[model samples]
Target chain A: MKTQRSRGMTPAWAVAALAISAGMMVVTGCHKKTSTPPAAMAPTESAAAPTATISADPLSIDLGQAVVLNWRTTNASSVSIDGIGNVQVNGTQTVSPSSSTNFHLVAKGDGGTTDASVRVTVRVPVTPTAPSGEGDMGSDALFHSHVQDIFFDYDSYELRSDAQASVTAAAAYLNANPNIKVLIGGYCDDRGSAEFNITLGENRANAAKQALVAAGVPAGRIRVVSYGKERQFCTEETESCWQQNRRDQFSIDR
Target chain B: MKASRQGLVFTTFSTLLALSILPAAHGQDWNVLETGKSASASTRLAAADLKPTGGAADEAKHTFDATLYADLASAGLFDLVSKSQNPQATPGSQSEMNLGQWAAAPASAAYVAFGNFAAQNGKIVVNGFLDDAKNAQYPQIFTKLYNQDDSAEGARQAAHEFADDIILRLAGTAGIAETKIFYTKKDGLNKEIWMMDYDGANQHQLTHLGAISIGPRVSPDNSRIAFSTLDKNGFQIKVYSLLLGRIVAFSSVGGTNLSPAWAPSGQQLAFSSSRTGDPEIWVSDPAGSLAHRITSFAGPDVSPTWNPKTGAQIAWVSGRSGLPQIYIMDADGSGVIRLTDGGYASSPSWSPNGQFLAFAWDRKYGPGAPGGQDIYVMEIATKKWIQLTHDIGRCDFPSWSPDGRHVVFANDPDGRAEHTRVMSMLADGTQKRALTGAGADMPNWSWK
Candidate 1:
């Protein structure tokens, strides 16, 4: 082993035989092992065996803020985020959600696949300094930020219990703030025809106005306008999003 | 490919009228007789890109050609021959056309529309001609000369005018080309009134109110658009002057006002108002000099639409029966007769001839209803209605075209998305065409 440089003096025939055997072995070694790792199993059966949890660092975020998504998986060979691409089984991703977004994760493993989703809600920054016509803007701005909008069921103008409670609170507020005139803008989820939505929105708005009047606010002080589905609060195609769009926002118009 | 000879060809016009007086005589007979339904086979028609003979900018001719091609394609009656299939010849005038090529195989166009345009001296002079490809001698079936503003839009308008004439000459029905569709286009939270040509060309916002508005009914004379707008206080009927392009003087009915319908007389308007304690139909002169109640139903009554031809009869929705249904009566609320059965129905628009009523109806309105909201047309004489749309995404706000041959309506084609679009179809429910893309709603077709 130590006399390696002097191998040429050993034997010509021996070297030839050694080279032939080495060539045969090298030819057999050129088999090229598979380049593709087997496809990630879809985890069809008993997918519930694999559980995934996607937790946002902050459940809610300001419009421009970012949320760190930390996901952990058990028995998952591959993990994919809804807005984010495939990632390691356990990792964290930072996403700046402009609107309420659901981060859906599909966890795959030998047993099965599981679906887990986490929501990040975006809060629109209230602009108080924006020009809003007259000093009425002050009341409008304040009411917009503080007053709660009364929500309605789909295609229903009649007030629900929660809506009635909000209307009661609004009635008390209107009575206290005698100088402020409120405009009840009724809206609808972007369903149905706009024409009917006009009528539907009107009914909703008027329903709110009538409730306020019945609660002792002067009928003359309350103005109602139905934006219909025209002014959609949420354009997303989801029941929860649409529910947010169907509501009556109280604004001080004059 | 075998040529479809489904439409009746008027090749037997043995009497050749003098060329000088042909314009007056051209309106007598069309090649295709109206069968009151879609043709067994679509008419194979071709259009030559308008040749620019006048010294106008290139943009004018190109738009005129493009719009004319698109307008004809949208006519629904024609199986328009593609520009690539058509002969590379822009027939400048009717007399110069070679019909043999258009009638030949591969380009077996039953009819051909050719035109020439010139933008000169601040005016666009257009010469449009439609010819029967099978007729040798008197091949010219229709010809019209239009002088409009020497701008791109004006040129397109000129093209629309000529296309209307061609459609009239072929379909035996007046085209909606000259008419405008008044609709509301959604921009963010603001829905504003907008106007477009019948073919959805040249869509421009008519109101900058920066608010929500709907139910834009253009006056019969195209002078004003009566729309409902949300102002600071509440919703009111607002009139926008086409001549002035601004919100002009309109009746300010107290309380919430919506659904403004213009009378063909151009003297009156009918709308629904909640001012009288309950929603009711009210009519007033356009000037708002005074207003009178048209409906005094104890329950809610709304959505008044007038017969565009007579203006003497009006149809509206009444909820007095617990469920809304269409009811028609004299403009003064006399001789009231219900037009729809006991189902949820609204938005009744009368035909131009006052023979039929088109409205949105939910025939199976109850728990576990099987069908979606559909459009129905009722014959005034028999009180019988036929469903025009079936499960075509909550179709509503049915408005009739000026010719009475088609209906323009708002349909939410994409079911759950909540976005609706303007669509047009024949009165019998055939040839359904989407007139506007998503977000355009409540299309009210203008009268002739």
Candidate 2:
């Protein structure tokens, strides 16, 4: 029976492999070729050339530290840093050391040829560097602890800087969890008329979902619903109750 | 003399009752007194000259000319000639007749008045007319208003008294603008109390609580509205002043207070309370003081409506007979009498004329299968019951128009799953129409 079952699954596995190979090939075809500099102008990974440098580093970094990079070439035209890391390029065209650094830097010559390399180092600040809190709460506990809130700007769902921060954190957590699906429920305070608030609440949930997708979270994992001001946590006419009620809550289905 | 004035008051009150239940008519041409528009040719006539036929009718005509214009215009029937037609003229003064210009004016009909005012037996007498003739010397009709007693003091009553007479002569029915109906609407998450004209126009929500409100009743004089709303101590009875825009609440000492019914004189209100444990009928003065328990039934008793025709009688919903049923009793809660016997019936709304009672009755089966919740009106005199609605839905909250010809209510046969709408049907259960778009429920028809 086991042999027969394995035989039945073989064709499925073959089909999946074929599909994945085709996708990879398509992706490869879209890449543009970068011209290489003359051999004499080849800059070592640590050197900063007159041309721009390709910056790279570790994905995680500690706060407030220096990092170093090893490279061999100089006279770089321009150098630019990209992604979320702090680095300083020295006269030697190499990334300086820092308390915690992980980034990629590319050095280019005047002819447009580039030399790129990655450097990583720990830069711990006040708190100890720890892994993500996902594992500590167990899937179910973590789901409940994940505070999903969509802040508003004085009766508006327009995204603000602080709102982006909250959505970013939520997206990161969602990206780490594959098996969980979440429903984003939007709510509003009792300020304006009832009918207007219902539509406003809907817009808020949609905005949060949009933020998550931009942050690399899968679209299929998030569903949105608006309760308007229907289910207010408090019935008081005070501003405090209104603020608390005008938020979004994320619920996960196991 | 006092007795005659009381008679006039009764006549005026009865006219108000006449405006109670007007049916829904399509494309009604309401003749509003165009505030900033040109005056109707009839405005040139004196109250006495505007009257038609007898001198007795003329006196009444002069008494309620303003009320006649307001009621007929609001009913979407007669157009009121603007009172401000001649802006330079004083408020109480009349304009001089431009006979040729008046005749050429754009009115389908004209009213001209001329009369003598006299004091008789400590009462006042005024004659009126509705003269369509070119000269005021030859008037078309005449009406009279004679008050033999000086006990009554309000000008509103006298206005309606004369307006009623004019309405009968012109439209063959009583006018309704001077009357009013108390109702409730779902304002966002909370139910709001409101009152408006009889034609489903002039709507204004009265309450703005962060809590739920339900069931409102109007006083006979159309001055005060009584309703129930939830507060810190559960649901309580509240009386709202239509003129003052003020609200007075009556908290329950023992149980929840709800479903208030106004006495004919507008002096006291009867309501249902659970203060003694189970829902029972109780009477309290308009001030919410001097409470007296009326019913001693074992089950919940609610939905009280006063019978204006009867001296001191009321109709209410009682669950004493296993299911909700309609019952009638004396004003003081004595001499209990059963009205409806077949099935579940609640939300009793008595007609202004005291001829019929409209209520919500539950059918044996749910919607579509066969039976469902329906609106029904039963004749008080003959005990004849007529089912007003029959379909796959349920209808509740039946309120009568002052004319006793129509009933407005809310229908949600599908329960809370669908939108509830305000609907109206003829008193005989025909020509049902939905006024509100959708998702609206618990409508209270205004007598105004």
Candidate 3:
């Protein structure tokens, strides 16, 4: 064995050395000038742990307008919205707040007690003035306003019985805000074929349109578009990401 | 041979017309060679000599000419010669053709396509002419598109479409635009034959037996199908008439009888069977009344497809060269010659043109994961080849659409379907559309 090894060793070791040198060359070749330390790593290391923040879009909501409250926390083990008798989390529950009601976001973490609250004053949504009719589009046309977010169940286009209340609420808003058209965009999770999902999303959006129109919202005030599973808010391929995908976003036009 | 014959014919015609050089309609001039009586006599005599002449060589040439004319006429692309039999005149000349000849060759119109199939740029190119012979003008320049990718088994489809287009252009009616392919699909643990539209729609199972079924073939009229089904008893050929929607044992022949293809007249089917203790192609009447053996190859000779334009010729895949290769021979199984040279190629489908054969070429590689199956096309004359699919996934059982412009095959689009799904693509291997239904395979394109 030793004799045979020695006979093939010289050339083999040379090839081995060459290969090692080639690999080292590649590694060292990638070295760049040590500029300032990476800004991203430095900020996270020095700053206090990123605490979750919760806030409503509008601090003070006029009775009818929706105050979208959002929350996030790096340390919180579990966090949810509490208080405000009928405060809803879109898919979770329905919210019917009064003057004395406050929306509470209780977040518990390893560091300390952290709580966020939004005092939601419930009132009838206000009616907006009709367009002056000076724009390129007609006042009754769909191009002037937008709808917000709609929701759906897991892998379903059938509007759940629970979703009707949200649809009714949005319809009431549309009824008050005349001359504004809203576009309802339907979406589906990244589960099935894209083509199938596109059809499903379209069906969901149409269902919403049907419900809103039936609820007294002008047919012309609602337009439906299906984005399918295209605009995923979360890139992760997890259940949570999928949950976020089954939704419809509303956008109002001029 | 073509150039020499062209030279001889051209020289002879030119000498006869040397006296007059007045240009005719197009660029060529008509000299009215010996205009008055002698010219008339020459044609009369040529027309009077109707008897087929000479030995095998002359007979073969005459057959080739007749084959070409019949194909062109049926293709609705050429004029047939019904004038008195012109046995004296040489092939390809006006002496044999009377202006008023062949008035009944379908719609009072005849088209002649003359093209040479050759290997070009690593692929086969069949470029020909669509001549409106009666009108004395070129209708269109027809081309049979081919690529090496399809040479494995799709050449027949490419050629069929090329021929169909000739008929469509001249008749203003789609030719063979309705036809279905019958093939076996892997269903669960067993392979079963299934049928579907030419575009891979409305796919349904034709057999539900736990036994294995393979090699389903559609009849010429697209009304019936035949295939081999294996039972504990043994392998047997079964025929299913679409009109009746019933399955029946065909021929009661002992042993395995498979790979049945329809004749042009839809009167007979050419199939391979081991009833004689050796696999060979046999032609049988629809009633299975007359069984004639067409092949006696020592090795396995299967997957036989008959030429629609020539009742006397057939194509089948033979494993004579250690590996399966396609071979074309007389309908009686004479004049056998290997047409393909590659690995594990089988299941040949004849084009309507009688000019090409399509078949599957299964390529095997070393251990880890085997290579995929592909469709290929081959020109009968020049033996040029084109390969069709290259996806890593297994692609098999290609069925040509009725129009012959597309081929439908079964493949797992996701690369890993526990069960296969049917997919189709245009003849050129573009515009692939997957069928939406769940767990589908063994798709046959229906003539409807």
Which predicted model would earn the best lDDT? Answer: 1
Candidate 1 stretches greater than 4 Å from native:
A1-254, B1-46, B49-59, B77-96, B104-111, B115-126, B132-135, B142-144, B147-151, B170-172, B363-371, B390-392, B415-418
Write model 1 residue lDDT over A127-162, tens digit each, in one string. 433323234234455565545798888667789999
Off by over 4 Å in 3: A1-254, B1-192, B207-210, B363-371, B412-418, B436-439, B446-448
Ranked by lDDT from best down, the candidates are 1, 2, 3
Q: Against the hidden reference, what TM-scores do the models get?
A: 0.64, 0.44, 0.39
* Model 1 chain B poorest 10 in a row by lDDT: B12-21
TM-score winner? 1
Q: True contacts preserved, each candidate?
A: 0.17, 0.00, 0.00
Error of 2 at B34 (Å): 34
* Model 3, position B362: C-alpha lDDT score: 59
Ranking by DockQ: 1, 2, 3
Per-residue alpha-carbon lDDT of candidate 1 for residues B72-114, written as tens digits (9 for 90 to 100): 7766667789888888776888766889988986789989988
Better of 2 and 3 by DockQ: 2
CAPRI category for model 1: incorrect
Count of backbone collisions within predicted model 2:
97
The better candidate by TM-score, 2 or 3, is: 2
Off by over 4 Å in 2: A1-254, B1-166, B171-173, B365-369, B413-418, B430-435, B445-448
